[model samples]
Each structure stands twice: as structure tokens, then as C-alpha cells.
Target: MPQHRNISCHLYIGDTKAMEYNVHNVDNRSTAHIVSEEGQTFSFKIEAGTALMSAARLDLELWADGYKLDCFTFTESVYEVDDAQVRDQVTGAIKIVKLRFAKLNTVDQGPSNADDAEAEQLKRLGTLEIKLWRSESNVSQSTTFPYADCPLQTPIHEKKIKGQSVSHVTSLESKGTVAQQSSWGYITTKIDPYDRPWVAFVFKHASKALLQSEGIVPKDEVKEKGAAVASAKGKKAQSSRAKVNDTKNEESKVEDVKFDDDVAAMSQPQLRQEIMRLRKRPGDSLDQSVVKARRTMKCVRTPDADNLLSTAEKGDKRK
Candidate 1:
């Protein structure tokens, strides 16, 4: 038997209730249309057979309220069988599937000239539901859909940490004072400890004096110099420590060699005695010593050269 295949996908924005509210606020709802990347229109009707066989492979786009909902990809197969025998056998099989995403409550309602700077505002509030099922005949399949409510609160807000003091600058004088204080604190905390407070005090006084004078602002050059000085001191300390470690390592190596020489000198007599005792043993030790000594020893020059010459001459005459 040849199996029939069908696929269909639909993108839904707002529900009936949300749509009612959106229509009243005409600017919030997006018109129903498939928009391609290049601003092209895509319109196609899904056949029953195609929707049944390949609905699971379709991708859905959902937009509602002010924000665009996340896109959902279907995974359930829907099938419509025309063969009487096959239909009778699989009478209760699901044939249609649909997916709906959460609705966005906010839509841009400001004038076109506002551009991207305008904050998105919510036009209506509602939950979004997605439904998936199969239809046996031409009748629409009834399935319960699951939905999630769209949160109405703004996503971004100015937040202050607990236990922090809030400071506001409303006038030029207040803004200048706040900026000077902030720069002074930044310099004190970020620079070297030795120079931090001194530089901060100098800048703070200079800032105050400038505020009293023609309302001028002091620069942050002192903070920069303090940081540079601290960094140089740290490098110097690190290098000095490294030099000390190198000296210690050299001394340790010298001590190790001296210890080894002392040990060898102390053990020399004992080593020789041990070798002699091994030579007296009844095995190959004595033979090995004779070979070793012969290889190692050299002839010594005698001070009695005349006696050595006379003995050699006599031996020659006798021979």
C-alpha cells in the first residue's frame, strides 16, 4: 500500500480576547502575513494530506502584544488516509497538529521618527497557547492547547543595591561636584595604598578650590601617576625576591657538593679495608681486585736511581 503524506504550518499572533483589546489599540497588532528575509510575501494553502504527513516538520512564528514570541518547531506527525481499508484500520489516528507561542504584550506605538530610542510599550495582556492533533475526516480536529501568560512588567529598570545611597545631580553645580567626588574616590581605591589617600586629598581640595574659583574642573592625572608608581614598586619587590631565591639556590648547590666530598673522604679508608677483606674471600673477589689494581696502578719514580741502575747492570752481567 502506498502511504500518503501531508504537511501544514500556521503562525498565529493574538487570541480572541487579546485581539479584542489589540483592535481597540489599533497600533499594537501586526497584520497576518508571511514575511521573508527580503520583505517578500509568502502565501500557500496546506493540503489535508500534506498537513497530516509532514505537519511535525513545520516551523511556526508567533508575534503578539508588543514583543515577538519565540518560534516553535513541531515534532508530531499528522496523517490523512483516503483508502477505505486503511482509514477503517486506523480510525482514531491523529492527523492535524498546531503550535502556538506566548504573546508579547508590548508593541512599538511611538511615532516613526522616534526610531530605536523609543521604549516598547504593552498594548494588551494575554496568554498564548499551542495546539497539536490529527483529524480523521474533513472535520476540524479538537485538541486542548497549553498556554503561558506574558509578563506585563518592563524587562529593564534602574536598580539600586540594598544599603547603597542614591545620589542624583539635577544642576550643573551639583553634577560637577558629584563628578569630582566620584573621580577622587576612584583614584583613592584603585591606586597604590601609599599614594592613594594623598593624591585623593590633593585632588579633592583642588576640585573644591576650582569649584570656588571660576567653576573649573580638575583633571585625573594624579590618579594615573599613583597607579604607575604602585606598579613600579610591585615589580621591584618581585625582582628582589627572585634575586634572593637565586642566591639561596646557588648556596644550596655548593653545600651539596661539599657534603658529598666530605662523605667520600670519610668513607675512603673503610672502602679500602672492605676491598681487602673481599680479596681474602675464597672466590673471584681476589682475582678481580688483582685485575683492577693492575689496571689502576702506575709505576712510581724511585729516589735511589743509582742503586736501581747498579742492580740492573748486575742482572745484565749475570744474564
Candidate 2:
């Protein structure tokens, strides 16, 4: 997470903020070093900056692996964004899609053209950045924007790609489970964007091993000896507690929980609301219709994080 102008932002991987390694600040920008994994979903959350939220109009841009995903705006009324917004082109409609981390593969052209201008683009890879800009007016965003059309970098020569380790890049997730935003909105106005952002949050993310190889995060740095010992003791205590309680067992089965009628009444894509309604209940029957609905739902359903999110209360009531 990085903070500037009383505004703080953190990269989220499945609802939890990615663990930041080395964090430092310089002027209007803050950089955090983090780790990410392939196939895992990711997003960003912007905390409301009271003063900035009250007085200024804002715009946000999300960039990952040199590809700018989406641009959103905020006004006095709307000051923050919940999840990262990505457009889904698969559907002919202007629908939003989810993004997940994936291995960034390079088209190797071997070591001869190391000085090529395209190699410069590699510098932006393995980094996730969010820019906060001061806008003159609320903007009506044109469906298509310049950044979205930016071309991906050309293949780097083989020699340059051989030794360099590029970690992961954002890839579209077909089966989306994140629901941070019910819908996205923009303030419609025609205006040029600011030359520079008011503040910037840069997150340099890669695999932990790669980060350590580059010396960005130290390797074998077990300086917290006491904490390590304490952690082990805590784990032992937790294990003892788990023996008498089904809390841990029940919590881990969050993905196994079936849907309810209310959850099946929603609109749009992802899990078909109709299939959700077919879930067995006191009055429900597991007949042909429900069976067919269940088959249709196999493509969209995912582990529902919300079911076990209430930390204070948990466990099945069955005695």
C-alpha cells in the first residue's frame, strides 16, 4: 500500500491486500514492493481521503505490465473506487471482466537487438501502478480511450530475454468471483487530462524468489527470531483449539456451500441467477429442472468469500 495527499491505496489479491515488502516515499509518489502469483485474481482499493474527497474532482488510471486497463473518475460525491475495473470484449456488449495474474511470456528474438526502443517497454513490466489525477470537471468517459489502444511491446531479442526474469502480467479471468463494484459510472464532460497526476502509487510485484534474486527483497533475512518462535507457539495453540471446534473445518468448506433463492435473483452475467434458485431448500425439489440449472451453473460458480467473512460468528449449528 502507498499513501500520498492523505490518500492511500493497496493492491488486493482476493479481497486481501498483497503483502508489501520494502515501502518508501519520495515527494508525490510512493512505491511498494510486493509479490504476486499466476492464476490468482487481483484488484486495488483506494481509501477515501477526506480533504481531497471533499474539494477535488479526480480521475484514476490502472496500469499493469505497461498495459493500461481502464480509466475511472470521481467527484465530490464519488471519491473512491472499490475493485479494479476491466472491460470484457468477449461479449459484444460493454460488459466488465475480471483480471487474474498470469505468466508473462516473451517472444524471444535472441540477443542481437538489445538497444532496440521496444526493449524500453520491458522496464514497465512486473509493475502495477495507479495514478490519481486532479480533474477540472467530471468527465463523460468516451467508451474507447488512448491508453486502452496502446500497442503491446514488440518481441525482445533473445539475448536480452534470456537472463532477465519477467514475473507475471494481468490476464482476463473468464470465471469471475469478485463483486467489489455493482456497476461503474463516470461524470460526463469533455476536457483534457492533467499533464501530471496529483499523486501516484507504484507497486512492483513479482514472485518472491525473483524479487530476492534481484535483491529488491532480501533473502535469508530471518531477523525476527522472536516472532518466528511466537508464530510457532501460536500455531500450536490454534491447532489445539481446532481439535474441539468445527470452526476451522466449517470455514474451509466455504466453497461447498450451495446457493439460496435470493442470490439467484440478480442480473447480468457470471453465475446465472436462475441456477442459484434451484439450490435445494425445504420447499425445493432436486428434479430435472434443478439438475439442468446446476449443470448450466458449473461454468460460473466460484468459492464465495462472503460466506465465511464474518470473523466474529461461524460454524455449522448442526449438533
Candidate 3:
């Protein structure tokens, strides 16, 4: 009897769910379909391989989701090994492939306006997942690896014991399984929760470098700028309203000061004496009345004006 290995691949962009493919026995050609963000179904074929062959091949053909990855290629040659190499593992290794894609559009997770900076950021975001199992049956399974879990962008920490170097480490186990889901070991810098870090499958490749070159910064800056702009607008509105209120009140206060001839006839000394007398002889002792009388006398014409008026009256009588 011929030994058969079931091949399956699960693809995810960020933490968002994508598609899965399963094929039984690596003997002939198999087909799978993926629906794009644009609601179009595109087909591709997976060519089977034997143990002696260097690598398995994937023939991808797609023109949907505002992306054109017709000739997208991948290889699975690492599984072909001698019996000596297979003994090093219990369940064997899970093959993971990460690729970088640009200028791709997502259905509802991106900005509505295509030209926005946020939209550009979304386009820069890519998908990455692992090919979980190769079994005897066609049963399919899928799982998402967060950006923090990705080897390409995993955060590094230096532990010190009295300022001595201990060891540099990653979250994955020695056999490539995720050791734990701890925040200390991971750094997820993507603004959108659904977006994943850009990581290429080639072990020598680094995706964090691409992130720096692409000018990906923390989204906190965007929020800070927006709040500053709103605060400035509020201050400007308050100033404008104050100016309008001042202008409106100017006309109504034109006759706020009035002069009385009888008040002007009294000298400064006499006026002060009269104010004091009124304070002393008051039936109702509300200090508000005294303050109002003093303010009215201060607004009247001075002693010079009283003398001029008296002279004018005498001249009129003589004529």
C-alpha cells in the first residue's frame, strides 16, 4: 500500500479570518477557491509532491480584493528529510510562511476614501499564517497567529541580574510552538486591531525593518493632534463671541452718565458734607442709596461750570 499525507494550508491577514484549503494524498493536482474583497471568486491549484522531490509547489491565480496576485508562489521543501532528521521531533514541525503584499484592498476593514493616509496604512498591512498539519484525512483546521506571536516582529527583552547578561529569548518553544500569550513578549504596533505585521517566510528576512522604512508610527500621535486642533477651535469661538457681545452693548450705554445743575452748584466740601448728612439722617439705612447719591454728584459739572451758569443768568436779566 502507498503511504498518503494530507496537505492543508490556512491563510490569515492580521487577526482577521481568511480562507483554508485541504487536499488528501500528495499524488496529483488539487484546486481551491478564495473570494476577494471585491466579492469575486478566484481559483488556484496545488501540485502534489513525493519525499524525494526537493519542494512542493503552489500555483496561485487570483484577480480580486483590489489585488492581482496571479503568479504568487510558495515552496514546502523542508518536510522532505531523512529518517534521522525526523527523530528529532515528537509531532514534527508546523511549517509557517509569511509574505509581504502591498497595495491590496480589504472589504470593510480599510478607510472608505482610497486616497487617505489611513487607507495607505491599511494597504501596507498584509496577511500571514501557518500551514498547520499534514495528515491521512482531508479534515481541515485553521488558527490565527497574532503579530506578537510572529517571529519577525516579536519584542525582545534583556533580563539583568545585577547588570549581567543572562540570555536572549523568544516566546516560541524550542519546537516552534507558542510558549505563552504574554504581553511582555510581544509588540503589536498596527493601528487597526485586524491588521497583522508584515513578515516574509524566508528565515533571513526581517519585516520590522520594512515597518520602520514605511514610516509606521504609533496611532497615538494622530489622536493627540486631533485633540489639539479641537481645543484651538474652542478658544477661537469664545473670543469671537466675546467681541460680538461687547459691540452689541456699546450702543445701549450711550447715556450712562448724566449732569444735574443743582448738584453742580455745591462745592466739593459741601457735597461731601451733604453725603455724610444723608448717611446719618436716613430713615431706611440701606448703604446702596448712599453709594448711588455719591456716584450721581461725582458725575455733575464742577464749581467752575456753576459760576459760568450764574453769570449767564445775570446778563440775561440786565438785557
Q: List, residue by residue over 1-319, the lDDT tens digit for candidate 2.
A: 5777777887788878788888888877899988889888887778646635444566778777766777876665334343343444343223344667777766554556645554665667778888877655545534433224323334445455556667776665444533452343565432334556667899888888899888887766575677788899999999889875777677645533444333344344334334444443456664654555544344335344233221111321221
Alpha-carbon lDDT, every model: 0.29, 0.61, 0.33
Error of 2 at 194 (Å): 2.7
RMSD of each: 30.9, 31.5, 19.9
**Model 2's lDDT to the true fold?**
0.61
Candidate 3 clashing pairs, residues 3+ apart or interchain: 13-127
Question: Which tens-of-lDDT digit does each residue in 8-69 have in candidate 1?
Answer: 32221222111111111122121221111111111112223455352224333333323333
Relative to the true structure, candidate 3 reaches a TM of 0.26
Give the C-alpha miss distance for residue 27 in model 3, angstroms: 47
Question: Candidate 1: lDDT of 46?
Answer: 23
Q: Which should have the higher TM-score, number 2 or number 3?
A: 2
In model 3, state the lDDT of residue 318.
Answer: 77
C-alpha lDDT (0 to 100) for residue 307 of candidate 3: 46
lDDT at position 90, candidate 3: 37
